[model samples]
Each structure stands twice: as C-alpha cells, then as structure tokens.
Target chain A: MAEARRRILVVEDEYIIAVDLADALAESGIEVVGPVGNVARALAVIEAEPLDGAILDINLAGDAVYPVADALRARFIPFVFATGYDRSAIASGYETVPRCEKPVDGKRVADLLFRSIADR
Target chain B: MADDSPAAAPSPGSDELLRVVIESATDFAIFSMDPSGLVTGWNTGAERLLGYSETEMLGRSADAIFTPEDRVAGKAEEERRVATAEGRAIDERWQMRKNGDRFWASGLMMPLSAPGLGYVKILRDRTEQHHTEMRIRESEARFRLLATNIPQLVFRAQADGRRSWGSPQWIDFTGLSFEDSMGFGWLDAIHPEDRDATLAAWNDAAEIGEYYVEHRVRRATTGEYRWHQTRARPIQTGTDDRDVDWVGTMTDVHDLRELQGRQQILMAELQHRTRNLLAVTQAIAARTLRASASLDAFSTEFAGRLRALSRVQGLLARTDQGAIGLRELVWGEMEMHGDIEGRVTITGPTVTLTPTTAQTIGLALHELATNALKHGALAHDEGRLGIGWDVAATRPGYALVLDWCESGVALPHGRPRHAGYGSELIERALPYQLGAMTRLDFTADGVRCRITIPLRSANHG
Candidate 1:
C-alpha cells in the first residue's frame, strides 16, 4: 500500500501570494486542497473535503480568519497561520498555532505543515 | 532721660501742632463753623481741596458748600442738628466746590463749643476710590456671566490646591455643587483610574503656579467617562511673588481624543499595508525570476507582471469601492494590443469582482493575451479571437462560465512539446487559486480555453 497525497488547504486573499503558496505546496510532493480567497470558501472546502492539514492567512481581505480557525480546531485538524501581520494580530486561543510570515520559504512551510499534521 | 521719653518729646506743642495740621494737611480740609452753621475760618487744605479761598468762604453759610440738591433737601441743617445733639456727624455725599464742580466728599463734623468757633469740619475727596470700586463690581459681573454661559467648567481655587468656587456649569456637568466640590472633593468627579495621576499633576502645578493635564472625567448625565483638558493659571495678588488664586477651565475634549485614537490606528494600519504590498512585490519578483529562461526574458516578463499588478492596483485605488468591474479588468488587459474593432470580440454583461478576483483574473488574462500574440491567434494578421461569458444556472448554486476561442488561424502541429508558465497558470492556477474547472486545448483552428467557477464563491463582488 502506498501513502496518499496529503491534501492541504491554503486560505488567503492576496492573489499572487495565494498562487505562490499553492505552487510551493505542490512542489513539496503534497496535494493542495485550495488556495481559497476568503473565509466562506475556505469553510466550504473544509466541509466538502478531507484535508490532511491547512495553512491560513490571519486576514482574508478585510475579515479575520478566526471563524475558520475555530472550525478547524473544532474538527481536531492541524493548521498553521500564514500572515503579513505580527503575532499580536492573531486572536486569543489561536496564538499557539504555528505562524509563517508572508514571503515565506517554501521548504520551511512544507516542513511546518508536515510536522503539524504528524502531531495531529 | 529725654531720649527715653521719645514719644512725648517728639510730639510738638499743642498750639504749634494745630497750626501745622491746619496749614500742611493737603488731603483733609479743616474748617470751623460758628454756632449758626456759618463759615468762620478756613485752612490752606480747605482752599486746595475745595478750590475755595478763606476770604471768599469765611462768613459765608456752610450750606453754601453743599450741592444745591442737598441744600434744598435740608441735608446741611440735618447735619448741624445731628452734630449739636451727638457731638459728631459723619456723612458721604457729593459737595460743591467754589468752581461749581461736584466732588465725592467723605465729611465729619464735630462740635468744638470753645466759645468763638462752635464746630469743626473735616472733608476728604474720595472720587478715585469710588470709581475703582464701581469698576471692580462691573468686571466681576461680566466674568460670572461668561463663566455661566460657556460650555466649559470653570473653577477657582486657593493657593493651597483647595477649590474655593465652581461655576454653575461645573455643578451641571459633574452633579457636584459648589460646596460639594470644595477642597479635594472635586477629585470624586474624575475617573477612578485617573484620579491619582490628576492629583499628582495638580500638586505639581501648585509648585509652579501653572496647571495643565488631560484625563478622563465622569459625566453626570449618563455616568459615562469622557476626556477633558483641564488647564489653569495662578492669580498673583501683588508683587510678593505668591500665588493667591487659581482660575481654571475644563473643556470637553472626548470627541477629539477619540479622533486621535482612530488616527493612530489608521497610521498603524497604513504601515502594515505598505509592508504587505512590498512583500507581495518581492514574491512576484522571485516567482518571475524562477519562471524566466534568460536575463532578458526575466526582465521583460518581470516588468510585464509588475505592470499588470500595478494596473489592477490603479483600478482598485481609483474606485475605492474595494471591488473592480469584470468588464473593466478584461478591457484593461486587451486594450494594449490595439482596438478590438475587427480582430477581437469581447461580450459580457457588466459584473463586479472583488479585488482579489480581479487581480488573479487580471494576471490570467495577461498570460492569455501574451500567448495569443506570441504563437496562436494574434500572431497572424488574419486570426480572429472571441471572448465571452455568461451566468450558468445548471447546478443548485450558479456558475460563471467564460470562453476564449481563437479562429481563422491554423493551430500548432499538435500539443506543444513542453507546457510553460502560461499554460500552468491557466490550467493549474485557476483550479488551485479560484476553485474553477478549466480546459485548455489546441485544435486545427486555433487555441481555445473554457473556465467555470461557482458564482457564490467566485462571482461575488
């Protein structure tokens, strides 16, 4: 038996950042679930698909990604936050989640995602 | 012995003292009147103070020195009777001088009863003091009027930091009356968290004679805390260099404070956005560098991608509506190739797109147009291109379907040997970034691509 390609969701609103994130994840030999632009689409993807892990932008357009974080936590799924904001910008309870700042290194994020998923 | 009895030795003889007092007393007019209230004698002070001469005033009736109104009212007769019965009479009234001018006179008349002279009278001019007192009354009235009418809370305190007075406005605002706010009781009106600091500032001002501080105060109307700027200046009573009183004004600055707070947050947000934009630009440079084949290719492609991003950013900034129209995005990318009069056709209903969607689709359109000019359709003079879109109602949720078809030009020898960044962007980026289903193909006619995305997620403006 062979291991399945890990489907990881990417939630961000910035266009180039989203594309680059998807490309980075794909290059890491893991399947990408979404590069969802907002919270609603990210929630829809989470509901309709079985994701191994997820990477989230702290802000989607002008809305905070806390609702999506709450949902992911409720389901016991592992996730990391990718943001252009400081750690203080994240809401409480989600502070312990790993964060990768924007213009993140691809391999570093890949390792973070795998480690978070493995812990889960 | 003489030195030890200085008090008595310094006092001159009675006769000489009388002559000196009568001759040298310039501030007091000393005169004598006969029993019938007739002027018998006048001194130099009387001449100077009343503009009268002893020759002209002597033997004249003392009633002559009274104003006509007082004379008609029998005030002089009443003064003579009072002086005779009680031995002394003191009065303040307007009196006439020899020049017929009136002056404020504080006068005292006493019975001498030493045979020749029956009574002695002394008069002092008090006009300057009277005017000064009147002016002080008027000024105090004006200050009270202003303090009561204006919106600020006015207060007066002693040099020891004890409040002595508070205007009606203060009572109305803080629900503390003048007596209630006396001493340090006014501190109760300040917010608890700010009370100690406010007291400290006030104490500091006591030493410097200047009080200035901004802090939160409780409003009596709703019991809510609001910011106020309280300032005061010390009133120095004389040249003694000691503060006598403190006059202060507390202005309601809650709205201004809130505006300043919002401005700080806006400044911080602006900084965050600037950094994020730089990060985005850096990411584009890295991705463009990775995709280019050579230095020239990197420069051209990187500049083109940056231009695309900048154009979309311009549209977003101009609208400020946070969303861009789909028709505008399409035309912005295609108009660069020249007119679409006969060579290209764009047909789509006006639809607005979120900034994120506009940016992603904008880059995708740039790739498609670049490909059309390089290899497939626009590369030939006779090629034709048609781009159209429609809202599909097939599924429970609607979908936006867009089609790109190039005709009138021969296709390539089959599929190309390798797929470049252009194909990967159209086929892979659309699905991965936008959750859209995309198809790209090369037929014998030209290149064609179709895209479908859930309207709920993709078409929301």
Candidate 2:
C-alpha cells in the first residue's frame, strides 16, 4: 500500500497572500488542500477532507478564525496562524499556536506547520 | 481758705492762659454744656473736629451733636441724668458732625463746681481708627473662606519650611487631619518613593522662597498613589530675612500622565502597522509583475490592485469604526468597473468585515470583477452576473457560503490550464486566508464560482 500525499489546508482571506502561501506550499512538495477565504469553508474542508495538518490565517475576511482553530484543536490537528497583526491580538487559549506575521514567507510557514504536526 | 467764693477763683492772666491752651488743642473738641445740656462754650479744637465753629454752635442744644437714633432713644438726656447723679459720665458712641457725617466719639460729661451750671462735655473723634479695625476683620474672614473651600490642597509654611496651615482639602484627599499634616508630619502623606526627593526640593525652595515639585501622593479613598504637581511662592516680606511664609497648592496630574503613556503605545502600534502595509504592497507589486506577460499588462494590473486597496482604505476611513460591511465592499468594486446596476445582481443580508478582512476581500472582489470585464460574461453587453452569500448551518458555529454565477455569454472550452494570480486567488488564496472551499468553473456558457468559509462567530454580522 502506498502512502497518500500530505494535504495541508490553507485558511487565508487576502488574494495575494493566499497565492503566495499556496506557491510556497507547492514548492515544498506538500499537497495544499485549500486557500479558503473564510472560516465556513475552512471548517467544511476540515470536516470533509482528511487533513494532514493546517495553515490558518488568524482573521478571515473580517471574521476571526477561532471557530476553525477550535475545530482543528478538537481534531488534534496541528496548525500555524498567519496574521498581519501582532501576537497580542491572539486570544489567551491559543497562545501555544505558532504565529507568523504578515508578508509571510510560505516556506517558513510550511516548515513550521510540518514541524508542529511532526511534534504532535 | 475754702475758696468757695467766685472772687477766689483764678487771676486774670491765668484765665487767659487757660483759654489759649484749650483753643490750641486740635485733637480734643473742648466744649462745655450747661445744666440744660445747652452749648455754653466752644473752642477752635471743637470747630476743627466737629466741622462747627463757636459762632454756629455756642447757643445750640448739645443734643444736636448726638446721632439721631441716640437722641431719639433719650441717650443725650440719659447722659445728663447720669452725669448729674454720678457727677460725671463717659461714653464711646457715634456722634454727628456739622456736615451730617458720623464720627466715633470718645466723649465725657462732667459737672463743674459752679452755681447754675450743671455739666461740661468733652468729645474726641476716633472714626479712622474704628474703620481700620473693621477692614482688618473683613479681610481675615475672606481669607478663611477661600482657604477652606478651594479644590486644590492649599498650604502655608513658615520661612523655615515648617508647615503652619493646610486646607481642608488636604484632609479630605489624604485622610490626614490638620494636626497630623502640620510641620513635617505632612511628609507621611507623600509616596514613600518620593519622600526623600520632596524633602530635598523643599529645603532648596525654602532658601529661594519658591516651592515647586511634582511627586506622588497617596489618595485616601482608593489608597492609590497618584501624581501631583505642587507649587508655592514666598510671601514676600520687605526685608530679605523677613520672608515670613510660603503659600502652595497641589494639583492632581495622574490622569494626564496616564494619557501621555497611552499616546506613546498608540504611536508604536501605528509604526508597526505602517511597516506591515508597506511589505504587503511590495508583495502585490512583485506578484503582479511575475504574472503579467508585458510591462503594460503589469502596470495596468498593478495599478488596478493598488486602486482596489485604496478604495477599501477610503471606505474604512469613512466608516471610522474599523469594520466594513461586506455588501459595501462588493458593491464598491463592482461600481468602480462602471454601472453595475443592471449587470451585477448582489444578494446578502448584511456582513461587516474587520479591517484586515475587508482589505483582503476587497482585493479579491476587484480581481474577480476585472476578469469578468475582460474575458468573462461581463465582457458582453447582454451578459449578466449574480452574487449572493448566506451563513452555512454548520456544527459548532455558522459559516459563510457565497455563489457567483454568470449567464447570457458563451463560456470557454475548459478551465484554464495555467492558474494565474486571480485564479490562484480564487482557488488557493480563499482557502488559505479564510479556510474557504472554493470552486472556479468555466463552462461552455459562462464562468461560475462557489465559496464556502466558516463565519467568525454566530453573532457577528
């Protein structure tokens, strides 16, 4: 039996940021599941698809992605939050989640996500 | 030897000396009244002090010299009766002058040992002294009132920096009684961390007759140490060593200090946000260049993206509350392309976006609309586009699902083989940024897209 490609869901709202992140993930030889624009699609994909891990934008089209974060947490799926804001903007319970500030390097984010999942 | 006879009285030369001495007296109004209280004699002193000469007053009733109220109350008659019974009477009361002005008179009535003459009256003016005393009392009362009622913590200290007085406000603010704050005891109300510095400043100020310092004082009500600016100036005495006292006030400045601190933090945050925006702009330019085949194409696309960003910024600025409505964001992009009234049909309840979300979504909408105008259904006059969104009934929380459809135009053969930034934005960026599951399909008829993403929370618009 052959192992499946590791599919990572990408949750971001900005077009440019999402494209850059997807390109970085593709360059890393990782199968990208989504470049979702909001929390609804992110959670839907998370439930319908078998995710290896996830890359999340802390805010989604004017909405906070905490619901998606909480869902990923419930599933024991490791993820990294990509944000334009600082760490203080993150709620208390999600402190341990890794944060990557804006103008994010996709390769760095991918590495962090993989490492976090591996650690898990 | 008994000297009871008139022939035994005084010699003619001695009588002349007596008249000259009495007339020369300017302070006392030497005048004599008969048994009936009639003016019998008046001297130059009487004329100067009462504004009346002997010619005008000698035959007048002496009762005219008393104030009307005193005369009405029988004070003049009472004085005569007292003088006749006791052989003398003295009083300090208001006496009328010839000009109708009143003077405080120190007067005496005495009986003379002469036949048919009852008494002689002596009057002196004391008006200036009485007015001076009253003025001093009024000034003292005003000072007492201001010291007690003012809001600032007022204080008075001796030349040597020994505090002599503190306003009631000090007691109210620091819960220290006047007795406790007097002298050096008031130092205890100051913050312990500020005590040494305050004392040093106080000593310095004592020499210069100016006291000014800012330090913390413990507030009694909250037991919190709050900042206060204290200032005092020397009560200037004419002589250098006679600088007798310092009056000072302490004003609360803790709120202003805290506001200044907050302003610094906000400034830093603004700097950070500006840096992030610049980086994002750089990335947009780089990606647009890579995705374009020619400089003109790159310029046009880049300019369009920048405009998209600026439009969102304008909207955010106008709203001022930091949240932008999703309907407004979508309409803004479509409207910029030209008249969107008939061609674009949008349906959604209401959705307000955060600053980050609105900007990102606004750019995505711009890219979508631009592509439609260039190669999609919107390129044709009869073509139509419909956009709508709704919250998905998802477990744990609601999610957003949006649909875009176009009609009245022939579609392409199939989905484009190479994914450009716009396609990538729709297919990959949506999922990455918003965790959205999106589908972009090009059919023989038109292009359609469906996006489903999780809402932030159930209550959010």
Candidate 3:
C-alpha cells in the first residue's frame, strides 16, 4: 500500500506566523490544511476536513482554543500546541502533549507533525 | 505747785514746738522709755508707724514691741546695755506691731539726761526693702538651676579665654569632670578628624568676639562622631575692654546629614534601571517587526509580546539585582493569556531565577503556550496538557530540561497552507536566544516539545 500523505491543521491568531508554518510544512512534502485564525473557522474546518495531526495556538482573538481542542479529542485526532506563553499557562488535561514555542519554526512543525502521525 | 525762787521756767512756745515736730514725723515711731523699759511718751509718728494710737500705747511696756523670739533672746536688754555704756546704739531686728504681725525694724536708742527718762527710741519699718532683697536672690537661684540641668554641653569662660565655669551638664555629656571641662580639656572629647578644625574655629571666635559654629564632636557614651553647633557670646564687659565671661552651648545634628546622603544614592540607582529597561523594550520591538510580513499582524503580535515583557520588567524593578521567584514568573505569564487556569498545567520545584534568565524563559514559554491553546490540545474542551521541568548537574554546567505535552485533540484536514510567526519564533528564535537545543514532536494523539539549556546560559541570561 502506498504511504498516505500526512495532513495538518494550523489554528493561529497571528497571520504571518500561521502562513510561515504552513509553508514550512508543505516544503517538507507533507500536505497543509487551513491556517485558521479564529476559533469558529478553526472548528468548522476541523469538522469538515480529514487530518492526521495539527498545530494550535493557545489564544485566538482574546478567546481560548480549548473548545477546538475538545472537539478534536472527541474525534480521536492528535495535535501539537504552539503558544507564546509558558506550558504552565496551558490547561491541565493537555499537560502530556508536546508544545512548540513561538514565533514558530516551520521545519520543527513539519517534523513534529509527521513523526506524530507516523507513530500512530 | 509753782516754784518761785531758783531757776527760770522753759517757755510754753518751745514745748509746743517740740510736740508739733514729733506729731508731724510719720516714718519713725519716736517715743521715750523709762529705765525699766516702760513707755512714758508717744508721738503721732509712733502711733502711725506701730499701728497704735498714742492713747492706746502710752502705759504699755516698750519690751512688748519685741517679737517673742527676740524677747526670749534678751534683745531688749542688749539694746539697753549698749545704750547705757556706749551712750547710744542702733540695731536692725524683728518687732511686733499692734496688729500682731511682724515687721523688720531699724531702731535707734539714746540715753536721756532727765532722771525719769531712761532712753529715747526711734524705729523705722524695713519690710519693703526686705522683699526686694529676697526677689534678687530668687532670680539668681533660678539661673543656676537652668544652667545645671540642660542636656547640651554649656560653658562660661572669661573674655581672655580662661574657662570660669562649666555647668554640671557639660561634665555628663562630655564624660569629663568639672575641672576637666574648665579649659582645653573640653576639646579632648572632640573626634580626632574634627579636633583641629574645631579648635581653630573656637580660637577665631574668641579672638574676634564672633559667634562660634562647628559640627565636630564625639558622643561621650558611644564614642561615635556627631555634628555640633557651638555658639558663644561675651556676656559682660568692664572698663578698658575687659570681657567678664562668655557662655556657649552645643547640639547634635548627625542623623539628618546621613539620611540626605542615602536618598541621593537611591535616586541614581533608579535612573540606571529605567534606562536598561528602555533598551530591552526597543530591541524586542525591532525584532518582532523585522520578522513580520504586515503592519496589522506585526502590531497585534508585537504588542502582545511587549506587554508580556513589561510585566517581567515590573517584577524586576522591585528586586535588588533583577531576581524574582520562578513561580511568580510562571503565574504572571499565565495570567496574560486571560483565564488560563483551566487551559494550562504547570509542574516544577520552586526556585528563584535571575532577571535575564527570567526574561528569556518567560518569552519562550509564552510563545509555546500561545501556540498550544490556539492549535494543539488546549484548542478543545476534552483536550489535555502536561508541563514539567527538572535540573541536573552535567560536565560543562547544570542543565535545565522542560517538556510540554498534549493529548485528546483531533488533527486538522489536509495540511496547513501557510507559515506563521509562531512556528518561526518557537523553532528558530527561542534556541537562538537561549542557546539551547529544542525538539518538537507532532503525533496522531498529541504534540510534545522538549528544550535543554545549559546552566551558565540560564543564569547569565
């Protein structure tokens, strides 16, 4: 069977950071998903798309992205956190997941997402 | 019975004139007493002076005028003896008046030639003069009392610079005896550093008769230095430009001077810290803008990060060398995320961090947490996270290891179409600033990131 191309979702509040991350992942040969900036759009995209892994920013226009995290968890999908705050600032339940500090490195995101999907 | 044969009788006019002279005298009680001291005659002067009328006192004994104590001491007899042998006598003594009150009296008595006339006496009241003398004595006593009890060192010296007197208070304050404080011995208590200058000032003041001022003395009890303002003036002067004495006092003013010095040092330190903070803020702004693609995105993200930096700066301002509790740094960053309690997890031993390390770690942690909430595990309610760190001793130096992990979040469809600022900051900028190695793992179930920083880098930064 041919290896399936890994898919990722990027939900970030900063447009330039989100764009940079998407490009880095694509250059690494993995497919890119929506770089949604708001919680509502991010949720809609998550519900509609098929993804293997994801990268998330903890804040979206003064709102938390925990609801999106909750929906992704219910669907049994995995994601990585990318935030500008310390990991201690993240919710308790998501403590064991990996986190990438921003401004995000595109290559690191691609590498993390691919490894996460391959391991699963 | 009229005598017609032998001698010429005195004129009636001469006797009348003698009665008128005695009646007009008001200051003295002029009367005649017999050999045994019985009163034989009283004039209007005697009536007014003794508060007794001539009719009331004519038959009374003159000895009754002496006070009880004077009479007991034979003062009346003493006056009689002096008058009889010395021809006349004058004395000052206490005497009782008709009202039973006492008056100080100046009395004179003379022997008379008439057989029945033993002595003639005159008395003057001296109570007003006695009171005036008493007031002058009391004023001198009060001045002495004040000179003895004052806390400051006090001295009185002759115009020629010889110490005439020093208050007992001076001996107590200067740890010297009255004799020691009289002259040059008083200068021995002055601090060695200030002794020369103090002596010069004192000599100048004495020579020129000018007011002396100096802040150069040592405390007797503690042997500590203090500032003292000594002032003196010529109190009296006589003929030929001779000054009688000079009086002076010394007071302490050391603590006020020390407080002013400390205040100036603190002001300078504050100025230096403010300038350092401004430089750091400028660097952060320039970096954020350079990496941003557009003005809107740069402003939003830069402002947010700058606010985080400012919070760290506020904490640093309160510390002596820009150090703070590690826990405080963590909490401050979490609070910036707006209700991050339910969305964040932190685990570590409590520790203090230096200013530069705190800032570097703070910015790195901020970027990571922001990303996690926006796109990773914290994006959904059911998603979970874990964060922890540990310190270990290594060959080069101590090492700090931190991990962030997430689970229970679904992946997105297809792939992310655009690169963003968050990714570049976390993977590139963080390692560059911290001089550390970092790893990021994205999985089907969650994401994990680990960073290892050398102890030296952690401390210096």
Question: Candidate 3, B126: how far from true, in Å?
Answer: 7.6
The best candidate by TM-score is: 1
lDDT of 1 by residue, A23-73 (tens): 878888878887788889999998999988889887776788999988898
Off by over 4 Å in 3: A1-120, B1-169, B195-216, B219-223, B226-310, B313-323, B339-343, B354-387, B394-461
Order candidates by TM-score, high to low: 1, 2, 3
Error of 2 at B327 (Å): 0.8
Candidate 3 residue B422 Cα shift, in angstroms, is 10
CAPRI rating of model 3: incorrect
Q: Any runs in candidate 1 off by more than 4 Å, and if so which?
A: A1-58, A64-120, B1-25, B30-44, B54-56, B59-97, B100-131, B159-162, B171-189, B207-209, B217-224, B235-244, B262-267, B390-401, B405-409, B413-461
For each candidate, C-alpha RMSD in Å?
Answer: 6.9, 12.4, 22.0
Q: Indicate the DockQ of the complex predicted as candidate 1.
A: 0.28
Query: Tens digits of per-residue lDDT for model 2 on B1-461?
Result: 66788888876698799888888887889888788877889988889888888988877888888889999999999998888888889998999988999999888888877746867778888787767666756765676688788778888887555788889899899999999998888998999999888888878896776888899999999999999999888764323456466888999999999998798666655644554565568778878887789999999999999999888888888886777888888888888888777888999988777677677667777777887898886898989999998877787588778788888877668877775667777776666665668888887777788887777783356
Better of 1 and 2 by lDDT: 1
Give TM-scores of chain A for all candidates. 0.94, 0.93, 0.91
Q: Once model 3 is optimally superposed onto the true structure by TM-score, how far is the C-alpha of residue A110 displaced, in angstroms?
A: 48
Give the candidate number with the greatest lDDT. 1
Model 2 lDDT at residue B397: 83
Give DockQ: model 3: 0.01
